[model samples]
Target chain A: MRSVLCYGYGNPGRQDDGLGVALVEQLETWAMAEKIPGLTFDSNYQLNAEDALAIAGHDLVIFADATGEGADAFAFRRLVPHATIAFSTHAMAPESVLALCAELYGKQPPTWLLTIRGSAWEPNGALPAAAQANLAAAVVFLKEWLRRPPAAV
Target chain B: MNPEAEKVFNAGAARANAAYAGQRRNVTINPITRLEGHGKIDIFLDGKGDVERAYLQVPELRGFEVFSLGRPAEDMPQITSRICGVCPTAHHMAATKALDSLYQVEPTSAGKKIRELVYNAFTLEDHALHVFVLGGPDFIVGPEAPPELRNIVGVIGKVGLEAGKKVISMRRRVREITSYFGGKVVHPVLGLPGGVSKALKAEDLPKFKELATAGVEFAEWTLGVFKSIVLGNPEYVKMITSDAYTHKTCYMGTVDANNNVNFYDGVTRVVDCNGKEVCKFTAKQYRDFIAEHTEPWSYMKFTFLKDRGWNGFAEGPESSIYSVGPLARLNAADGMATPKAQAAYEEFYNTLGGKPVHHTLANHWARVIEMIYAAERIEQLVNDPEITSPDVRRIPTALPTEGMGIVEAPRGTLFHHYQTDVNGLITMANMVVATGNNAARIAMSIDRAAKGLIKGGHVTEGLLNKVEMAFRAYDPCLGCATHTLPGHMPLRARIYNQSREIVQELVQD
Candidate 1:
C-alpha cells in the first residue's frame, strides 16, 4: 500500500514553535477530503530521531515545523535530507531522525520539511501573527500537494 | 429537540449513580476549533445544583516572548506576524505601532493612512474568514449536524454555488490585497518601525477600489444569509432564548473621533451596557487596567477588567463582565459610521437594549456588525486620495529600545510589547493575543452552557452540539491555546450526573 504520512510537528503550546503542528492539523482535515485510498494520514508533536525510525517504511513523509529563521510562513522550498537538525527545538532533529530511519530500514521515506517563520515562543503557546497567517496558506499548499499524483521515482 | 432538557436528564441520571453522589468533578477540553490557537475548558461540578469552580484552560507554552529575545527589532513586524493567521496584519501593524512609540515620531499623514488601509484589509479578510469559514459552518449546518458537514464545504451545499464562490472570492481578494502590500497573506513583512516597506502607487488603486466594492457586496449578502440561518431561524432563536446562559458587559476597543469604528489607532474605552463609558484610557495605560489570571489546567491566560476586580461567575440573567473582539468593540463604540451599517447597528442595539451586550452568544451578532463596518470602511478608505500617496513609509530612528503596539484582532484586542538593545536585537517581549482576553469569559460561558444545558447522563447530539457551539461562537483557536500535543491529541467529552457522579465519558480514538 502506498501511504502518505503528513507530520505537522510543532509545539502550539509554545507560541511560534507551534507553526508546524498547526499546519499539520489543517493538512489532516484537507487530506481527509482529498487524499485517496491506500493513503493514511498521521500528525504528531515534536519527535526525536528514535521516533522518526517508527515511520521508516512510509512511502512519503512530509514534516512541517516553525523556524525562527524563515521570513514567512508559506515560504515553501525543498531541503536536502542532510540539513542540520541540532538547532531544532524538537526532542530529536529532523535530519537525525530521517538518517536513523534510513540506516535501520535500508531506505527512508521521501520527505519535505516545510518551515513556517515565527516571531516568539512565549511560555504558553501564544502564536505570533505570521504563524497564524501561515495556517491558511499551508492548507492551500497541502490541498495542492494532495491533488498531484505520487512521484514515479 | 430540547437541548436544555438533555441537561436536566443528565443531571437526574448523575443523582441516581452512587459514585457521583458527592464528587467534585473537573472536565477539560484541550482544543476548541475555528480560531488561530487551541484552548481547554475545565468545570468543577459541586455535588449540589451549582458549579463550585470552573476553569478555562488555554494550555499554551509561551513562545512569542522568549523566542524573539535575540532577534533584531527591524524584523519584529514580520516575526510578530507569526502569532496568528487570522490577524497577521494586526500583528505586523502593532509591531510597527510599537516601534513608532519607541521612536516618538508620528507617522507621516500618508503613512498613517496607508497603515489604516492595511489594517482594514486584514479586517475584511479576518472577519469574513471567521464568520463564514470558521463560525459559519456551525451556524449554517446546524450544530447537531454531523462533523463532515460543519465546514465551508457544507456551507456551499446549503447556500448553493454562488454564495460559496463569493466567500472563496472574497478570501482570495483579501489575500491579493495582502500580497500587494506585505508580499503574502501569511506573516506579511511590509510594516517596519518608521513606516511600511512598500508604497501604494496609482496602478494598485483601481484594483483596491474594485475589491472594496466587491467586498461590500459580498458582506451584505453574507449578513443576509446569516440572519436567515442563525438569528431568524426558529430553532436557533429558541436555543439562545433559553435561560441557560447570560453575561454582563464591560466592553473595550479602539474608536475614532466620533466614537465610531477604529481598528488601527484610537483611545481605549470600556463602556457599560447603556452606552455609557465606564473609563477611557490610551493603549499605553493598558498595563494598569488589565489583570491576567493563569491556571495549571490550561495554558491560555485569562484577563479580567481590574476596576471591579474578579467577580465570580454571573447568575441567571444578571450578565457578568466580559469583553474584547468585535462584539466588545461594538458595545464600546459610540455608534457605527456608515449610514447603512449605522441603521443596522441601531436596530441591533434597540432589539438587544444597546451597549455592554453581555451574552457570549451575542458575539455572533457583534461579528456580523463588524463585517458591515469593515465593508463601509473599505469603501471610504479606497476612495480616499491619501491612499494613493507615495509617502507610505518613513525612515525610523534607531534610538529607542522599547515599544508597544495594540490593535483589535478578529477575535479581540491583541497587544505586542518589546524591548531591544541599542543594536536593535530584541531583549524582551510580551504579547496578549485575542483568545487570552476571552479566556475567563470562555470558561464562564462553558460552565453556564454546560450547567444550563447538560445535566450529566446520556449525551444527546443537540446538547453536546450546543455546548460545543458556545465555544465555537468565540471562534476559539485551540492551536494558539495548546502549545504541545500530549504525544497525541486526546478526544474526550465526559458528562456527570446530578449527584456529582460520573454518568458517561466518551473518548474519540
Candidate 2:
C-alpha cells in the first residue's frame, strides 16, 4: 500500500514556531477548497528519533517543520532526507531519525522536509511580519503538492 | 562523538579528579522540556558513592512580572493562561481568585458551585492528559523498555487496542468537558474576578454526565491495567517503595474547611508526613511563606518553603523537598470529598501513608489515581442540577488593584499574583508554576536515582531514560517553565567554574 503521511513540526507555544501547525491548519483549509486526496496529516511540536517509528507504512512522507534560517520569511525547498538536519530545529532532527529508520528497516520512505522559515521565537509570543508572509507561501505549496499524485522514488 | 571519550574530556578524569579537591564534577541538561518555561537539571558528582549535589535550576528572567506591568487585572487569567497550555485553567483560576481576593468579593452560592464544577472540569482535563498522554507510556510500556516504545503509541501497541482506545476516548471526554466550560483547551478564557466567564448550560449537565460516566469506567479499566502492568511488578514496586532516594519534605496545598482536596479558594495548609499541620494560611499569604531563587543559566525560578531556606545536598529526601500537581495536593489534603476520589484516597492513604509521597516513581501511580478522582468529580458535578444552569459567567464590573489566583494545575498547585495601580494597570505579576513547585524535588529524585542506578559513572540508556521518565511523571510543560529561552543566558555560575552552574544543575533538554 502506498501511504502518504504529512506532519507539521514546530513548537506551538513559540510565536512563529506555530507556523508548522498553522501551515497544516491552512492546508486543511486548502484541502477542502481544492479537494486533495489520499493524504493524512498529523501535527506535533516535535517528534524525536523514536517517535518516527510511528510513521511506518507511509510511501510518501511530507515533513513540515520550522527553521531558524531566515534569508526569507519562508522558502520552498524539496529536501532530500539528509538535508533535514541542516534546516531542522528539533531535539532529534528529522534527518537523524530518517537515517536510523533506513539503517534499521533496510529502507525509508521518499521523505521531503518542507521548512517554513520562522522569525519569531522569543519569550514573548510575538510573530514577525516575515513569518506571517510564509503562511500563504506554505499553504500554496501544500495545495500544489496535494494537487498531484505521490512521486515514486 | 563517542560519549565515553566526550565524558573524559568533560569530566577532566584523572587529572582534575585528583588535583582539584574543591572542583566538582557536574552534568547539566540545559533545557528541560514539557515544563512551564525554562529550567535545567544539574548533577554534581564527587565521583564518589554519594551524590555531591543535585540542583533543579529554574531561572526565569523575562520577568512576566514586569511584562504584566501595564496589562489589565481583569485580563490576568487570560494573560497568565498563556503561562502554560497544560495548566491554563490553573492560572486562570488563580488569576480569578487573586482578583476576587483583591476586590474582597466572594462568589455567590451558585457561583461557588459553578467554580467548583469548572475547577473539577479543568483538573479532570489536565490530569487526564498527564495520565494518558505523558505518564501513561512509562507504566504501559515499562520503564526499562526501549525509547521507541516509551510513549502513548507504545502503550497502545503493548496493551490491547481496546484499552488504548479507551484512554483516547477518556482524553476526548476530558477535552470535551474542558472545552464546554472553558471554550477551548489551548488557552482557557472562562474565569472572571468573582466567577467563571460562562456558566453551565442545561444540556451540558446530561452530556457531561454521560461523558464523565464513560470516563469513570475508562479510568477504572486503565487503572486495572496499570495495577497489573506497572504497580504489580516486583521490580517496579521495589523501585517506588525503596528508601534509596526518598526525599521527605513538607507538603503544601489547598484544602477546604473540612480538610478535603480543593482546587480553588481554600485555606493553604502544609503538613508533615505524620499529617501534623505545620502551618495554615491563605493563598494571599504565599509571598510571606514562599521565596524564589534564580540560577544564572536557567529562566525558571526555584521556589522553596521560606522557613526551610536552601538546603544544600544533605542527601536523602529531607534536603530536597519537592511538590506540585495532584500527588502533592493529595498528600497535603486529609481526605478526598468526591465519592470516587475519597474511596481511592482511602486506598492510597492506606498504601502510601498519610504524608507527602517521596518516591518520584510513584508519581505515575499517583497521577492515574487522580485520574479516577478527576473522572468521578466530573460525574458528580455534571449530575448536579446547578451545573446545567445558564449562569455560567459573571463579568467583573471593575478591576482590582491587586489580585492573587491559585488553582491546582495537573502538575501541582499553580499561583498567579498580580498587582495593579489605581488605573487598573498591572504593576507586578508573579507565577508559581506547578512544575516550579517540584523543581527541587525532581532534581533530588533524579540525582538519587542516578546515583543508585549509575555505578562508577556508568549508566545504561534505559536507566538514563528512566531518570528522564521520572521527570515526565510530573507531566511538565516546559513551554511555560522556560519562556525566555531565546534570550541571553540569565547569569554565569561563579569563579573557578568554567562552566555555568545553572547549565550543570538542570535536567537535560
Candidate 3:
C-alpha cells in the first residue's frame, strides 16, 4: 500500500478558514471507520519549514487549505517543487515546503493541493453555510480521490 | 473609524499631497510577505525625488479582547495561542503565566523546570528557522541576489546541502522535545494554572538530554556559520553598522535578577540609548512604563516609554520610542546567563564596537547568540533532578481578580494582562505583542532606509531588498502583533506622480 499523508493548515479560530482543518477531522474519522490503511493525518494553523521533513517521508502528500479566491467548491491540483519568497516565518507555501524537501532531503513525494473555497474569515466567528457546503463537497471528492491508485492521483 | 482616527488620516493624506505638490512621487509597497500576516510600506518623495516620508502600516485583528470577555480565564492559554498560527507557544506561555498570577499560586519547582525546558526548546527551534530559512537569505545568499535566489533553497545552495540537512534535522529534533511536553508543537496543551499538565517521565529524560546536547551543538555551529557568512563579509558588516540601519533608542527586554537575558521569565528591564539602565518593572507595573501611540494610516499601535513620552517616530534618546526583540534583549541585559552564550554575546558587542548596538541588522547576530543561550539553558534544565519530579501542581486557591504575565518572545517582549470576576471568567484582556512594541522602531528603520537608499528617483530591486532587510532583522510577526479577520492580501506596488495619478502599478498574487 502506498503511504498517504493528508495535511490541513489554517487558523481554525477564523471562521471559514478552518475548513481545511475541519475537513481533515471528518476525513480522519471516515478513513478510520472504513479501516483504510496507509493513510496518515496532521494539521496546524499554518505550514512551516519543518513540514518538509514530514512530507518527504510519505509516498504521497495532500495539502488542504481554505482559499478566498476560487469559483468552484474545491480545486485539486498537482504540485511541483517551486520556491517562492515568503515575507514571514509564520508560514510557508506548500510549494516552498516541497522545494525545501527536494533541496535538503533529496525527496519529492508526489504532492497535491486541495483548496476549499471559503468566504467568511472573521475571527471567532462560526462557519457560514456556503463554506460548510463547500467543505462537504470537497470532503466527498477527496474521499473518492484518495481511493484511486497512487499513479492515477 | 472614530472621529480622531479619521482626522488623523485626513491630516496625513493632506500632508503627503502637499509635499507632492512640486512634482513629487509616491511609492507604495503593499502587503509585505513572509514574517507573519500583512504589512505595507508607503514612501513619499520630495520634488528632487529624495525620500520625504515612509510609513509601515499593518492590519490589526479586531475584537480579540471582546472575544475573550466572559470566557474562563484558564482558557486563555489555549484561546490566545490560536490567535496566531505563528508564535503560538509564546502566547500560550504568557497566558499560562497570567493564570498563575490570577490565582495567586506558583508552580512546583518541577513544573517550572518543565515549562522552562519546553520554552527554551521552542526558542532554539524558532530562532533556527529565522537564521536558516526566513531572514538568513538576506545575508547567507547576499541581499543583492535576485529575489528568486533569496530563500531557503538559495540558502542551501550557498551553504551546501549538508548544512541545510543539519538545520532541518536540528529543528525536527528540537521540536520533538516541544511535542513531548506540550502535546502539540503548534498549539500546545501543556501549560496549566500553577503547573504543567504532564510531568516529565523518567524514561523520556535520556531522550530529552540527548536532544538538549544536540541543540547546544547546533546553536554553536549556527553561530560559526553566521560568523563566517555575515561577520566575515566586510560589506555586510559595514551595512549592518551603517547610518541607515542605526537607531539610538531605548531598549526593552526581560531579564533575570542578575540582569541577564531570560526568555521564559524575568522582570522587564529598559536601557537608554547610551546603554544606561533606565528602569526595571514587574509585569503588573508595565502600564506605568509603557504607552501606545496610534497613527491613522495603520492598524498597528506604536509603543513608547510613558516616562519619556511619545515623540513621533524619531529615534535617539530624546524620543520615547523603544525597541524590543533579540538585539534589544541583549542591550537591556548585562550578559547571557549561559557560559557559551556569554562568550558569543561578548564577541557580538566587541565586533559591533560596543554596548547598546544601535544597528538594526545586528539583531540577526544577537538572535544567533540567543539561540546558544536557549540551547544551553535547555541542557541545564533537562539535567536538573527536579525535571522529572511528579510534584508539578501547587493548586491555586486565591480568588480571581487581576493578573499579568510577560515573556521575551522570539521577536521581542510579550505581555498578557487579564481582569477576571469572582467566577474566574475574563472581564477584560489586553496583549502587548512583540511586533507592536517594535512597530515604531520598524517604521523608523523603513523610513531611514528609504531616505538613504532611494536617491534621485532611482529604486532597484536590490535597494528595496535592503530596505526590507531593515525590518526583517527584527523578525517581525505581524500576525501575532495584530488580531484581524483572516484573509490574504495581494502584494502590490503603486507609483503615483505629482498629480496623484497612478504612473505605474505592479501586483503580485
> What value of lDDT does candidate 1 attain over all alpha carbons?
0.64
Local lDDT at B414 for model 2: 80
Runs in model 3 with CA error above 4 Å? A150-153, B1-14, B17-38, B480-491, B495-509
In angstroms, the error of model 2 at B240 is: 0.4
Residue A84 alpha-carbon offset, candidate 2, angstroms: 17
lDDT of 2 by residue, B380-472 (tens): 766777766665444556646766767777677787777778778888887877777776666557656655665544445566555555566
Question: Which candidate comes out best when scored by lDDT?
Answer: 3
| The TM-score obtained by chain A of candidate 3 when compared with the true chain A | 0.96
Where model 1 places Cα greater than 4 Å from the true spot, the runs are A1-153, B1-55, B295-297, B314-320, B456-458, B479-491, B496-502, B507-509
Instruction: Tell me the interface RMSD of every candidate, in Å.
Output: 14.4, 9.6, 4.7
The local lDDT score (0 to 100) that residue B430 gets in candidate 3 is 96
Which candidate leads in TM-score?
Answer: 3
Model 3 chain B worst lDDT run, 10 consecutive residues: B481-490
At residue B439, candidate 1 shows an lDDT of 70
> How many clashing residue pairs are found in candidate 2?
46
